[model samples]
Structure formats: structure tokens, C-alpha cells
Target: MKQLPLPMHLPARDGFDALVVGRNDHAVAHLRGLVPGAGVAAPVYLWGDAGSGKTRLLRALAEQHQAQGERIGWFDAGTALPWTLDEGWSLVVVDRCEALDAAHQQAAFALFVEAGTQGVQWAAGGRLPPVDLPVRDDLRTRLGWGHVFALQPLAEGETRAALRREADRRGILLPDEVLAHLLTHHDRDMAHLMAVLDRLDGFSLAEKRHITVPLLKKMMAENIHDLVPNPPPAP
Candidate 1:
């Protein structure tokens, strides 16, 4: 049977400002201070467990450079490109270094060497510190050469405060009870919580009701999925 494509998600907002720093303020600050193509001596390496915002931070840096009219080459473990260094690239970002296969690892190592020689700023993220990464010895050493930051997950209180901030930004009146219920009943990751808030806002609007615990329950009972529409299949 032919497989139906998965729904396309809207790109999540990622920037230093959009990030909830939690206990990772130093890491955020380092990335914020980086000037693309400024002859940075080494790559900034970030490591954290799943949902710890490693990917988000990398993307945020890339977006910042791109906004400044710098050409960026971004690669992840799943990137299918040949991973050759482009002379025009002002910055290069590699995410999910922990998941790289043999070929991708080789490609990443070569890209790092070329980027270093050509004065291209680079950053990388992974689930483990360079010393503990399950990659080649030389590549692991390269990963550890620069500033290494271990991202810490937000505490429960921090997550709640972040949700409240988002609600305020969206001009939504989120009640304490409803917020508590969401924290108790759903995934607590910032991304998942934010998506829940988005869906709840839409559901409340559709039902012509103010957001409340009852409204949240009704929305949950109906098992409302992401309100974002799926994109058309590729030709």
C-alpha cells in the first residue's frame, strides 16, 4: 500500500529571543555574541538530551546569520546532501551529531576541516559531549575544540512561567486552573505545551467560548489535533 505523507508542520519560531533560556543562559549568551564570519577560532558545540533545545539553538544561530545576509549551510544527521564545503558559505551548522552514520560522519569531518581552513564559522549540536560521542576519535576531538555547553532542561516552575509568558504575548487570558490542568495532563515540553495552547485558542474560538477548564476538557475529549493544515504532496 502507498503511504500517505505526514502532515507538514509550520516552522517553529526559533531565535535567541523566542528561546526560554531556563538554566542555559550562558549557552544562549555565547551564541548571541557570535558574529558571523568574524574569524571565530572554533565551533561552538552544544549537547543535551532530547527536547533540550539543542536543535532550536542551532537553528536560531543560523537564522540570525541568514537574516544578516550571510550564506549558511545547515546539515543534520538526516541531510541527504553531499556535505561539501561551499566557498560562499559564511556559516555552517550541523545538528544531531550523535546520530550521524558512518558516511555522514566522514562527510561532517571533512566539512569541518574545510570550513576551518576557509574561515567559515561553524556550530554543532549532539546528545552527548564530544568526549562521549560515538563517532570517530578525530571528529570527537574536533567537536570538543570550541566552547562546549551542556543545555539543561527547564524546571516545572520555569516551564509554567514560559507558558504564561507565551499566553500574554498572544493576548490570551489563560487561567491558573486551566494552565495547571494542561501541565498535569499533557506533555510538558515547551514546544508541545505551546502547540496545545495554540489548539486550545482555536477550539475556544470555534466553540464561541472563553478559554476555561471546561473548554479545555471538551477540546481534549474531542482529541483535537494540530490545527495547522497539511501541505500538498510533492509531485
Candidate 2:
């Protein structure tokens, strides 16, 4: 079997403008207000299902602050560094709160306390609401102490439209059949769909093939071991 090249990391389409609002307009608006001089000073906690743009929003806010040369403290459940509070930080962002282990939770709680004392603007995201998070009681309460927003997944039509727009933006001539196949055969989440599209586009370019159903299937077949549950028999 011919070895297929992996898709390189595509620049994420993250930012307030890139977000597909769907039913998350209010959440987006509130998040936008988190930037300095937006007149909204409360911390925010966002809860949603997978691929509901929680990470996107958090990253967007971080980017916005970073663009203005503000110091940012970003902590995620996967971070190897201790979640210590930095007094010089102008903004703080915490992601994947639900995945935090005992040590991370304790550190996060302390960071939260210090951030509160220093009036540092902060935001966090999790898969579950603060009330339902399986973390320490005090930390859970702190997660809910400010504005809480529930992000909604884009509807099917909305997702299709967004995909089409992305394709157009990328100058890829995405056919209907390819779009339908993606919707039916792959994960329906926007993030996953976008990643697949990115891979497909890269594959098409490397192979000098038109973006067709056959080409899509061929790419998937060549990359099956990387993409799906079962790998095809070795040639």
C-alpha cells in the first residue's frame, strides 16, 4: 500500500468573525465583551457538547488579548505546567475543566482565587454545566460564579452552509456529492468536518485530482488506518 501523507496543521478559523453563530449569538456577544474596554467585567463559564465551539471562543478571546499585547495566562487540563496564578496576567483562560485531575483541580481553584483577588479577567469551558462538573465543590461553585452560557451545535442546514462557505473561502470546488458523503460518513461535528475537508483538500492537491466522490473515497481508503476504526488489509 502506498503511504499517504498526513495533513499538516491547518490554521484554525478561530475568532469572533469566524464563528458560526447559530443559536450562540448571546454567548458570542458576551465573550466578545470580555476584551478590555468592552465594559463587561464578569468572568464567563461556557458549557456545551463536543465541537460546540467552546475552545474556539476561548482561543478567540485569547488571541484578541494577545493582539493588543496583553499578558495572558492560559491553562488547560492537558497542561504539564502547574496552574499557578500569574499576577502580571491581564487575562486568564481555562479549558477542559471537566478533564482536570485532582492536582489540576486544586491548582485551578487556587488560581481562580488569586485571579479574583487581582481582578484578572478570566474565562473557562467545560463539557458539562458547573453544577454537574465532577470537581471540588468550591471549584464548581466558582465556575458558576459568573455569567454562564450554553453553546448550541449548529443545525444541519447551518452546518452545510458553513461548510460551503469555508470551501468557497478556500477556493475549493466542493461538489454536492462530496459534501453529502462527508455529512453522512464522518463525524457531524463542525471541527471534525473542517479537519476532514482540510485533509481532503490537501490530498487532492498532492494527487492533482479533482475533488470528486471517487477521489474522496480514495483518500479515505489510503488514510483509513489513520482515520477510521479498522484498517484495510495490508497490500
Candidate 3:
């Protein structure tokens, strides 16, 4: 197969206000939109199902923003900021933007608008588009004023490719047969797959063995064989 671009950046630490997305195709594009004229729609707003890689893309964007020497501040809204948001920061990122209750939602929206003029570019993620939001007017309009993009869930094909790519990243030689089995029988979630892969990766490294069908079988038996029925009689 041809080489694909790197699976996109993963944040080392998750600031509460920002999101961490997965290896979905939209990751880099979403990050690039942060630069207003970087050939992406401006004032980008991302929407996606829960666990659909929204946070990961947000994190990638945060990484790019930080790389360019821009300061990014995160606000969960649920947590009160000890100081005013008027502090010096070029980017203010908020996730679960919908979590703000009605009474204070307008104040939150005003902050977003204020942040923009204050040299802080704002990006937020929520399930509904700002136009569709029924929250406070200022907040809803503020959300709608920017570019709005929704993240689609990864297809099975994409998920499988992600698995293979991750295995390569860890220097684990996942047998083609074992890879096929895992992708076919297990959950179609990249997040879940990665979580389990870490365990498999560590095991393979400790044993000084490449990932093989037998090794997978043994690992699964010790841990998650119950996840996949029968598991093809264990090779």
C-alpha cells in the first residue's frame, strides 16, 4: 500500500477546555483551519457524535497552535476560572460547549466574542451547530459566526488501516491474519482498539517476540478472548 501521511498529532496532556481527537482523516484539516487563511473555512466549529474522534482533532489543532508559539487557554465552563479570561492568550479553546446552562450561557458567549477582538482566536466543539442551538442568543450567535464542521465516524476500512498503522508505529509486527481477525471481530472503535493495542505492544516487547497469530491468541486468552467469540479456534 502507498504511504499515508502521519496519523496526525496526539496531545501529551489534555487541558480541560480542549479536546483530543483520534487518527481520523479530518484531523489535520481541522488543525489547519486554525490559521484563518490556511485554505480552510474560518471561525471553525466542529460537531460530532460522542467518541467520534472530535477531541483528537481538537488536540491536534492545539498542538499546531502551540507549535506556532501561540498561547492557548482552555475553559470547561463547569470549572470557574479564578481569573478573568481577558488575560493574554491568542487562542481560547472550549469543548462540550453545549454544557453551559442557560443563565450564564450568554456571558460565556460574550466572552468568546470578546476573546476574538482581544487577539484570542476561539474554537469550540459541540453536537449541534450554533445556529441550531437554543441556548442564550449571544452564545448561539457567537457559535454560528464561525466555520462549522462536523466530524464523521471512521468507516470500518479506515479503522482497520488505523490498526495496522498503529502496530507499525510501535514496531510491532502484527501478522496479517491476526490483524484481520481483530478488525473483523472486535469493536469498530479506534479508541478501544488503541487502548488494547498498548497492552499487546507492551507484552510483545517484553517477550522479545513479534506479534503473531499465536501470540495474539495467547494474549487474548489471558485477557480478552471473551471479546471475540470462538476466535477461529486459536490458529
Clashing pairs in 3: 20-55, 20-56, 21-55, 21-56, 21-57, 43-147, 45-147
Q: For candidate 1, give the lDDT of residue 93.
A: 92
Taking the tens digit of each residue's C-alpha lDDT, what string does model 2 give over 80-187? 856777767888888999999999999889888888888888799999999999999999999998999999988888888888888877788999988899888987
Candidate 1, residues 103-215: lDDT per residue as tens digits? 99999999999999888998999999999999999999999989999998788888888888777776679999998998898766666778788777667667778899999
Q: Please estimate how well model 2 matches the true structure, expressed as its whole-model Cα lDDT.
A: 0.84
Work out the TM-score per prediction: 0.82, 0.89, 0.67
- The predictions' CA RMSDs to the true structure, in order, are 6.7, 3.7, 9.0
Each prediction's Cα lDDT score? Answer: 0.83, 0.84, 0.63
Per-model clash counts, in order, read: 0, 0, 7
31, model 1: CA deviation in Å?
0.8
Q: What is the lDDT of candidate 1?
A: 0.83
